[model samples]
Target: MNTVDEAPRTRRGGRGSRRELRSAIDTTMLPALKRKLPLVEPMDAAQIEQIDRASMDILEDVGVIFRDPQAIADWKSVGADVRDDDRVHLDRGLVRELIKSIPESFTYHARNPANNLPFGNDYSIFVPMTGAPYLRDLEDRRRGPTLDDLASFHKLSHMLPAIHSSAHHIVEPMDHVVAHRHLRITYSSMKHSDKTFMGMTTSPKNAEDVMDMCAILFGDEFMETHAVVTGNCNGNSPLVWDETMLGALRAFCRRNQPILCSPFVLGGANTPASTAASVAQLNAEALSALAYTQVVRKGCPAIYGHYLSTVSMRSGAPMAGTPEISLMNFMIGQMARYYGVPWRTSNTLGGAKTFDAQAGYESASTMMAVLMAGANYVWHSAGWNEAGMHCSMAKFVVDAEQCAMGYRMAEGVKWGDFNEALAAVRDIGPGGHYLGHPHTQANFQEAFFMPELFDNNSIEQWIADGSQEITERALKHVNRLLASYEEPKLDDAVDEALCDYIARREREIPAVDALNNEH
Candidate 1:
């Protein structure tokens, strides 16, 4: 094991006086831990190969429908069988060859270099929740999320060490106009957090707007050379690709930005009911879209995204953190390894209406599954509730603690010389304690996982302290972080440019109500 001194220091300054002091302290005190892949595969070689062969057959025989004419034409150019009706059949050999060009791993650049995330391999990147319409907390009430709520989530994510990326639309800002809400949410993510972030994928225009904003922050030329942004493209399952998602995919791919080619499938609803069959269909959809990224630009950075879950057949409600989902996460990780591409999945997902026992168990099970599966990009790492319909601030804090625990789990156990621990054990023989031993004193802080919100007080002490529940304690932490948040500084010119772009684009886009009417 490398000494702590060998670990790199993360720079956190350059904004203001307070931030400078905070950054200096953070860099000197806290060293980033390098994560390792120590996962055991759920599927053996034959099972994985079977899934691959089945997926290939689905692509070649059933074929995939590309609703966009350009997509069909692009496939045709590559000698793919593009029927007049927009169904394109891919050659297995061609796909295998094209996918070989994709790099196994790449660095996702962040404005703050210290926050840069490594994709692929053993490294696991955690991102906040995306695309929720409602906000909830310990009060157990749900309401439309506002711009303020969105900013708070961003700040919370920024403050947490476990959350690596401030994902786009952590929650939909319903108060903002639909046509221009992305501008506000993206701006908040950029201004409030210096970490890696995702971009809008609602349409080609939205994607372009996000890129333009990124260019302002990172310079036009830098955007071309570095992947500073990522966007997600969802394939309309049952082997269909909608025009809007395809357009966004093209925009991101053309610029060499990473695109997460995901299939949003709910088993027994959009996909086959059987776990094996659902996985096969999910694999086909994800592979087709991933292959499309290569078709757009060979060697383009892409992630095979799996949003697989089962729906309750009786009530048709989406279920999360199920055994089926865990199996899918493991299977998808194997597939991604086979295809030589990074994969993305979610964590802390729960279908419970509140931050109760049900939510805790469900989220914990799902988080463990993703970590053990060795997911490269983890979204919804925190704050998801009500089956993805709501974002809870309390849950965010709770989940952040869980994520920190996951980091330790991913680090695995150190197998180096244990002389210090052994000596402590010897010194504190039978009927003795090691709490005050020299080695224990030296290593306890680093060896133990300390939770910020979980209560560990004695019963009497707890009563004296008002006996707060986990949710209540989490809210206190949330309030403290929000109160302490200092926006990361940006260059004066870049800040002005970003503001000007948002203003100009807001005027260019139709009003939200008007756009809704048109639709």
Candidate 2:
């Protein structure tokens, strides 16, 4: 074979060029990772077909509950069987036909043009964890999170390179009332970070309010055309979609913005104990909601989403990093690909109360499965612990660095300066090493992936360095990130508009003392 050498993407250009490249890539928002490695297909064609058939049979026969009058009306309009006024039997053909209009790929627009996320076709977006009710402070004490804590998480997500989105509701603003919390969280996400952010889905009005603020920031016409924000609606698992979630779905769909139709699955508690059976049921629930998005607005963007966890047989506790979890990840990825829609999966999850070895192993396992399964939107990719009960500030930074390392691995190996490397090997004899070679000097900076948090020095050096453990080290990094954070630029008029809207809404929606049920 006669062929010339191929230059790697990061061409060797000596010191000045390498420094320039470093400057460009070190601080800026990392784009959606374009994976070069092949996806891990854990199932054969026949196995996938088995899942597909089971899902279709569930939808056509068992039916999914659409617990809203409008959702039932929409289903009837789409020729679905609505007998019980809530549960609708969807035809598999109809779902397949409606979802065909979904765009296979779409750009997730951000306030800064450079941060727009590219979705689908082996592109993965790493997002921070959301919906954590408690916060594990830098002192390793658990407490209810406040608005300031929420803003801090947004700033960290912005400073981190691998995190793609400034995910809203990183933790619940327990200081704020439930009725008005969404406004503050959404505003903090927009102001603290210029990256794409998720929208509030607590209620229909809350979702509309987020869109209104986005209209101010991105312009009404621009907001109409581009997906500047995203909203996530989780189906109450075991084939149920509540009115609150459906309301948010319609609100987002009407604006032509992308919405994630996810089913929150806890195996054996909310679903069957079997992994394949739960995957089939979750797939059917997700497909019904995905099809509903098209019914709300044809051609609107949608994602097949789910939260997968297995329950313990002893106490019914949800387990993380189980073999069944990875299996579901693979099967769901396969189904999403077959249906031509983007998909989402959880990452960096653990059931440990502390960031110990259990947390590390669990998070590592989930992260590996997420990347290998080709999840398009990786939620809970960082800061998740205690089975999502709390967001740890220490684990947050470590997880971000972990995401950066994972991203590098997902990029596949680079062959920069192969011929030069071969020449260096030849110059260094069998008895000699290449540490002092010219190629080594030129490429050492870009050669290996250097992790920032983990300590790798010798015991003597480690002792001299103050004998710091991982949690303490991670705490230091968290403070450093917060101090280094720079708030992104926003138009003054737009900021004023967002504040005005929040003020008006707060006045309209009163803060109640306590709640027994929905008012």
Best by lDDT: 2
Determine the backbone clash count of candidate 1: 0
The alpha-carbon RMSD values of the candidates against the true structure, listed in the order shown, are: 5.9, 7.8
lDDT of 2 by residue, 1-519 (tens): 111121122235656655554454355777899988888888799988898899999998999999999999989987999877798998989989999998889899998888988888789999999999999986788998889999999988988899998899999988777888889999999999999999999998899888888888887788667888889999998999999999999999998888999999999989898988999899999999999999999999988999989999998899999888998998899989988899989999999999999999999999998999999999999999999999999999899889988999999988868888989877997899888888899898888888878999999988887888888788866765664455787889889988998999899987765433323
Where model 1 places Cα greater than 4 Å from the true spot, the runs are: 1-37, 137-140, 512-519
What is the Å distance of residue 137 in model 1 from its true position? 4.5
lDDT of 2 at 204: 89
lDDT (Cα, tens digit) per residue for candidate 1, span 161-223: 888878889988877778898898889989888888999999889998998898888877777
Residue pairs that clash (backbone atoms under 3 angstroms), model 1: none
Q: What do the candidate models score in CA lDDT, each in turn?
A: 0.83, 0.88
- All candidates' TM-scores? 0.92, 0.93
Off by over 4 Å in 2: 1-25, 514-519
Best by TM-score: 2
lDDT of 2 at 475: 82
